[model samples]
Target: MTITPLSDATWLAVAGPGRPASTTIGGWTLVGEVFNRHDPAVRQIPDDDPASYEKKMLARFWGRFIGVRLDGKGRLAALLRDPSGALDCLWWAQGPVTLVASQVPEWLARSAGAGWRINPARVEAALHDPYSTSGDLLIDGPAAVLPGAMVTLNDGIVSELWRPDWLARSAPALSDDEAAERLRDALDQVVAGVLKSGGVLAAEVSGGLDSSIVAATLARTEPDRVRLWLNAWGPDATADERPWVDLLAAHIGITATCQPRATGRLTLEMLTHLTLGIRPGLAAMDALHDADWARRFVAAGIDTVITGKGGDSMFIQPADAGVFVDFHRQRGWRAFLSRANIDLARWNERSVWTLIGAARRPRYTPAAIDDPNPLLRPRIHPEIARHPWLQGIDDLGPAKRRQILGLVQGCGLHGASFQTEVATVFHPLLAQPVTEVCLALPTPQLTLGRRDRALARRAFSDRLPDAITTRRSKGEMTAFYGHLIADGLDVLRPWLLDGRLAAMGLIDRDRGDVALTRESLAWRGGYVDIMTTAAIESWVRAWERRLPGG
Candidate 1:
């Protein structure tokens, strides 16, 4: 990637291996991977019509990109990421030098002056939910552009271009059958497009509904070019997911290779080499993938690996509480009560009146609870917590609301940091066309009769088996994460209690040491929190190593 200065007031950061081209539409200079989906070498951008170009860019349903356009004379610039943010773009301003790049570390390297400082409040917010970006740039003034957002920089001020009202306008306009047919067609288009130049395509088959759908679709469509891979564990391990995996492979007439899960003593010393380049604030669990798998892909000449990630996000999986609301709004109180009672019974929630009250309200109000932080919680500024990119958007109708929430929460999206190291991970479910259709699906078609992902079940019923499609209970990785921490807790000790977070006054060392005991780690959500906290610690250490003095 090279940072090309377009003009006195503007610059473009180009990354990846594509032959990027630039075109001047009106007064704006547009650059980055803007190409034809059918022929990447061919530019599909409209040169004569600026308005048409804007429409096409925003409405693009597929392909990878990090496009930017700048009007230097006007002192304005715009940045856009792919729909799922496959290519990440980060920008930070230090004095008069403003830097943006696909890699955050690269941008920081070019930063001049006093250098960047950690935002303790941002660190606290990241600990709250590590999976979500939470709008923290982790620096004093640097900011990250959110997925699907179009950010404009005007006179040093940056603002995002996402209208919630615009998304609500595209609500489901077709019947159940029509929606199913369209979704299937869109899935086919996305999957087929991804496999068009297929060379040793492999997919992660977890035996779950979503992966099954993707694996089965691939098997049916491009059986000759694809293989299945499963991350296997001992039968005694709660993370074991091979039975269903074998079942699906047998049904599809394909062979699957099971890769052993990564195990053994976990320690900061072992991860020290990896910490320096680790993406700040990402959960440590994200880095827990088996290295052997990537090597296997290389050995087998696999270039791309398909996954059923973002399936729930795109399809708006069955909502436990909100389904009642959709039921009441669509049907009368009678139908709402009937479905609510059944769902409540399934969840062991026994208040029909309470359910009705929940349904009456647009969104459920959670009871005030104690903070999840085990140590002294850092004081965070209200502005930091309420960053526009981190804030919840309102006014989007329920279906579209679910989809956008999933995207913002970052479902099915993988980090681009490892794009070149491992086999390219493709998520057809998150394809713009598929995601748009699924978001437009009527709420009833999604959660009616207490069936989650009903649209998907109906759409790919023939391709998947009855057992796989009908299974309702999803697997959890609590045991898996618990064991990961248990194996490495000793090595992660110093960082957990006395790391950068502690030095920043974001956590109390004494209290954190007491709170992070093995006994406490066994509690529900405890392992996950510990893992995330450790990740933050590792990131802080990484930053310390990269910057001046410890």
Candidate 2:
């Protein structure tokens, strides 16, 4: 652990290995990996005003980092988290003193003793949504400094340093070809920048357009640095992507290692023994595969694991009526009713009249909370915690609003293995430059009024295999997750039905019993929900055991 004093009454504490390296310039301290886009040496903050400093920093630097500036009296003046959310900065008041850290300090919680308690409301909110990126801390005391936002420590005033909607609205209008060219350049630059950092890099090539693009870019940038191209295949045909993986490897002239995903399937023991974080970090059922990969990377002396995680969100992959809505709003009725209408309708396999009606009355609904556990208690008004980006987006078209929401969802992509002890995980697609570029382009342009991520496909068409660039089908893990649930029922039954969540009034015993039965599991098919609930229950139990009496 490293503690750096930011002021007489405040300090920044970073725990665990690979703590971000800090650099001090003009009384402002930058913690984590940061690089100035224009001039690498220009790290000093010229402006004294917080707002001006924020503007300057946003315009100049691009990387995962946090900036903290102090007053002449050695008091913390302002702190800002980078837009990518690659680094975490959480703050909470400990009696009279304010504490800031990269994560929930376990020591502090232990010291608080009885005073520290889990925030049930926050936990319930998380359970209700599961996909929200509101960045609410699970414990009652602390609050996360959300990505692309800042805080005035002295006054406890928080404001936005970066706004996705503003960027979307202000993005310059560009032709399709122009957007593709700019996107290609941004991807190249971001990938190259990561490679320049130097590491025994490994990349997850999932045989999808996104991962393939990332792997291709890595090869194009510094092929020799990448030690492994890892791909996980499932037993079922839907989950088998080895053919695509082989094609990508052959195209890139690098041997790829394909492993069975079931090797790291979630087990009862794995759930109970999970390394707990501030909240439930196990976002996906297959997250254990990450831990397995981490061990392999560590044994092989790998320093970084690159992925194309944010590609779907950044490239606007969802096919929704919002696209047509945005076309009508931006390009006028004439354009929307003509080529745009036909294109969107044909892409979605819907009639022009249906598309017109959808455009006229577009619905931007959040994903429904679909927990199948009968014991799950009902809230008066259960809703996902609203993210900062979701606010002030009422004026935008549904597609743009959904695009921003996609970005919000992308913030939680890191999940459990966000910060591994040995190898760092890097998502080049989530870089600030790439995010901004994607946000700037209109939704129609992003999807080319046809397929998802059309612009991205165009951008990397030359570098990647035609099988990848033009490939429409994506590998599914439904069968893999289904098998996991079916196989683990022996442990999952008693674990969930008798777990902490049930005792805490979150799960209903009778309903849980019915939900876990073969009949119910087959009919409802809530395996994913059950897995999510089990993970959350495990997290709650883990933290409860950390209490003094526990």
Per-candidate TM equals: 0.82, 0.91
Candidate 2 segments whose C-alpha is farther than 4 A from its true place: 2-20, 38-50, 95-97, 112-114, 264-266, 362-375, 380-385, 548-550
Error of 1 at 38 (Å): 12
For all candidates in order, the CA lDDT equals: 0.61, 0.75
Please report how far candidate 2 places residue 527 from its true position, in Å: 3.1
Q: Given candidate 1, what's the lDDT at residue 433?
A: 63
- Candidate 1 lDDT tens digits, 175-236: 77888888888778777877774457878887788888888888888788785465455334
lDDT of 2: 0.75
Using alpha carbons, what is the TM-score of model 1? 0.82
In terms of lDDT, the poorest run of 10 residues in model 1 is 33-42
Per-residue lDDT for 232-253 in model 2, tens only? Answer: 8888899899999999988987
User: Looking at candidate 1, what is the lDDT of residue 418?
Assistant: 41
